[model samples]
Target: MRYDTFLDEVLVKVKTYLAEDGTLASSRDSKSLAKTSDLKLPLEGSDLSSILVDIDDYLQKCVKTNHPNFMNPLWGGLNIAALAGEIIATLTNTSMYTFELAPLASLIERSILERMCEMVGFSNGGGTLTTGGSNGNMLGMLCARSRGEPLSQRRGIDGTKLAVYVSAESHYSVEMSANVLGIGLDNVIKVGCDDDGRMRPDKLVEEIERSIAEGQRPICVIATSGTTVRGAFDPLVELSEICHKNEIWLHVDAAWGGSCLFSIEHAKLMAGVELADSVCWDAHKLMGVPLICSAFLIKDLSLLRKVCSHGDAAHYLFHDETESDDLGRLSLQCGRRNDALKLFFAWRERGDSGWAKMVDGYMELAGHLESLVVEDPQLELMSSRQWTNVCFRFKAEEEEDASELNTEIRERLMQKGNYMISRSNIGEDVILRPVIANPGVTKESLEGLVAEVIAHGEDARRGIPSA
Candidate 1:
C-alpha cells in the first residue's frame, strides 16, 4: 500500500479508539503482540493484507489516554494543536543536537525556556527542556552540586559530607538523584512537614543548622512547589530566606502543578520561586501537552552552561562566537527530539489567558468534587482541593467496614473500565485520589464518579463485618 493509504488507515483506527469507551491496552501489551513470530518482519515486501493482522494487533493494545474518564495518572486529555505539532515533529525527525540540524526547534526550545523562566520571576534567567520531571530534577541537583563544590567535577565529591535537603513528602526522584550523583541517599536529609502536608520551614532551618553543626556541608535545599501525593506547595518565601542566608542553592520541583504559573489567582501559591537557583517544571502535566515534556530552568544562564557543559568541546556545536545559544550543549543528552515543537504550538494556540482559563476549569471542577464529597456524609474530604487533586475517603456508614468496602469499590470500578480513580491511605483512612487535570471533566462527571464509588462501596459491604 502507498504510505498515504497506510497513514489514513492508522488515523482512522486512532480516531475510532479515541471515540470508543475503553482503552485499547498498555504499550507493553502492544509490543508483546507485535513481537509474535508471524508479526516479525521476515515477510518484508508484503501487500497491505499481509501485515493487516500485525497492524491491528499493535493498534488494539494502545492505551486510550485521550478518553475523558482516564483519571488515573496526572497526564490526561489531549490538545489538538499539540497533537498536530507532534505529527510535524515526527515527519521532520529533526535532531536538536545543534542549531544547524534543528534551527526552528532550537529557537523554539530557547523561547519556551525563556518564557518559563520569566514565569518563575527569573528576570535574567535561562533553562533547558528535559524529557521529564526526573531528568529536570537531576539537572537541578547537578547544577547545585557543581555550584556547591566547583572542584567536584574533576576531583569528585570528596568526603566533605555535602548534603541536600527536601521535605519528607518530596518526590522520591530527589533521593534517587542523590544516589545517582554519588551523594549517597544517607546524605539526603528529609525535613518534616505540617499537618497540611506543606513542608515546615522552621523544621527545615533547624535541620540545616544541625547538619552544619555535625561538620556536614549543607549545599542545596529542594523546595517542592507542588508535591506528588497530596498536591501540596511548600513555603517558598520562608524557605528562600533560609537558603539565601546560608548561601545554599535552592531548587523548586513544580512538576505536577507548575502550570499554575499561568493562573493569576493560584500563581501566588508559588511565590518566591524567583528566589530559587533552579526549577524543574513539567508542561505535560497541566498544559495538556504530549507526555515526557518537562524542563529544568535556572536563573543564571552561565551557571547551567558552566556546570553542565565544558565549553572547550564547543567546536562541533558552536562555531559562531556571536551565536552560541544552542540548547544541546547545555543538556545531558546529545540527540534530543524536538519536544518543544508541541509545547510551543500549544502555547501559541492558547495564549496566557487561554491557558489560565483551562487551569481554572480544572480548579473549578476540583472544587465541585470537594463540594460533592462534603454533601455526602459517607464520603469525607481528606484534604482541601489544593491544585487539581481531590483526596477524599469513603467513610464508614454507622457500622460498615470502610477500608475493605473502598478497596472493593475501587476494584469494581477499574474492572468495569468505567472511571479510573485511585485509592490511598492517609493516616489509616482509605481515600480516593481523583485528579481533574483533564479539561473535559465536568462537575456532573465528578458527581457521577462519587455516586458510582459510593454505590460500589455499598454493594461491597453487604456482608462484610464492621471494624
Candidate 2:
C-alpha cells in the first residue's frame, strides 16, 4: 500500500472510532483473546496492507476510553488539541534532556511547570514533567529525603531511622516511594483519617511524637488531595502547620484533585497547599491531557536539582554555556518525551476559565449522580462525595451477600460492555466507583449508568447468571 493511502485509511479509522457509540471494551477473556490474536513474530516483514489489518484488529478489541461510559479510571476522554500536539511531538522525535536538542519543548515544559507552581502557591518554584503520578510521588519523596539529610546524597544514611507519614487511605505509591528511597515500608507510618477520610491533624501529631520518642526522625509527611476509592482531600492547612512545627518536609499528592485549583469555588478544597515543600499534580487526570503528563513541583527548585543531581559525566550532551537551559539537570530522566506540548496545547485551547468551567461542570454531574443514588431504594452511597468519584453499591436483601452480589453485578456490567466503572471497597463493604474525569460523561450518561447498575442489581438478586 502507498504511504498516503495508509495514512488516509488510518485517519478514517480514527474518525470512525471517535464517532462510535459502542461498548467500552470487548468481553473476551485473556485466554480467549490471546488464542484468537496473531501472536507469531515472523522473521519476514509484512506489507503495509497487512499492518493496516493488524491495526484494525487491535482497535476493535481495545477499550474505548473516550466513550461516555468509560468512568473506570482517574482519566478518560480525548482532547483534540492535545492529541494534535502528541502527534506533532511524535513526528518530530526529540529527547528533552538538553536545550540544544529540544529547545522549544524545554521552554514549553518550563512554562507549564511554572504555571502549575503558581497555582499551588509556590512562588519562584519549579518542577519537571514526570512519567506519571507514581513517578511524581517518588520524586517528591526523594526531595524530602534529600532535605532531611542533605549529605545523604553523597553518603547514604540509615533509612531505618528516617520516618515518613501518610494517610492510611493514601495511594500505594507512598509505600513504593519509601521502598525505593531505602526507607523501609515499616518506617512509613500510616496516619489515621477521619470519618470523611481526611487525615486527622491530632492523630498526625501523635504519630510524629511517637516516632520522635522512639528515636526515629520524621523526615516528611505526604498528604493526599484526592484519594483513590473515596476521592477524599486531606486537610492541608493543619498538616502543613504540623510539618512546619516539626521541621519536616510536606509533599501534597494532588494528582487526582489538583485541577480543583482551576476553580475559585473548588480550590478551597486544597487550602494551605502553598505552605507545602513540594507537590505532584497530574495534568493527565482532571486536566484531560494525554497519559504521562504529570508535574512534580517543589517550593525549593535548588533542592529538587540537588536531589536529581549527577556529577558531570556526559560531556557530549552538557556544555557550560547551555547548562542553565538544560532540563535534564533537574530531572531523573534522560531521554524524556515531550509530554508538555500536549498539556500546553490543551491549556492554550481551554484557558483558566475554560478549565474552571470543566471542573464545575463535573462537580455538578457528580452531584446529580449522587442524588440519583440517594433517590434509589436499592442503592446506597458508600461514602461522602468530595470530588467526582461516586462510591455506591447495590443494597442487598436480608439473605443476600452484599459484596458477592455487587461483585457479580460489576462482572455483568463488564460482560455487557456498555458501561465501565470500577469495583472498590470501603473498609469491608464493596462499592462501585465511577469517577467523572472523562469529558465524554454527561448528566444523561450518568443517569443511564445508574439505571444499568440497578438493572444489574435486580438480576443478581434474582440469582440470574450473567450471559
Using TM-score as the measure, the top candidate is 2
- Count backbone clashes in candidate 2: 0
Clashing pairs in 1: none
Question: How close is each model in CA RMSD to the real structure?
Answer: 3.2, 1.0
Residue-level lDDT of model 2, residues 1-467, one tens digit each, is: 89999999989988898898876898459999998899799999988889888988888989999999999999999999999999999989999989999999999999999999999999899999999889989999999899899888899889989999999999999999899889989999999999988999999999999999999999999999999989999999999999999999999999999999999999999999999999999999988998978999999899988887783477887788887899998899889999999998999999999999999999999999999999999899999999999999999999889999899999999999989999998889888999999999998999999999999999888778776
TM-score of 2: 0.98
Instruction: Give lDDT: candidate 1, residue 243.
Output: 92
Residue 107, model 1: lDDT of: 87
TM-score of every model versus the real structure: 0.92, 0.98
Counted clashes in each candidate structure:
0, 0
CA lDDT of each candidate?
A: 0.82, 0.92
Q: Please, what are the lDDT tens digits per residue for candidate 1 over residues 326-374?
A: 6767878877888999999999999999999998888888888888889
Candidate 1 C-alpha RMSD relative to the actual structure = 3.2
Q: In candidate 2, how many Å is residue 366 off? A: 0.5
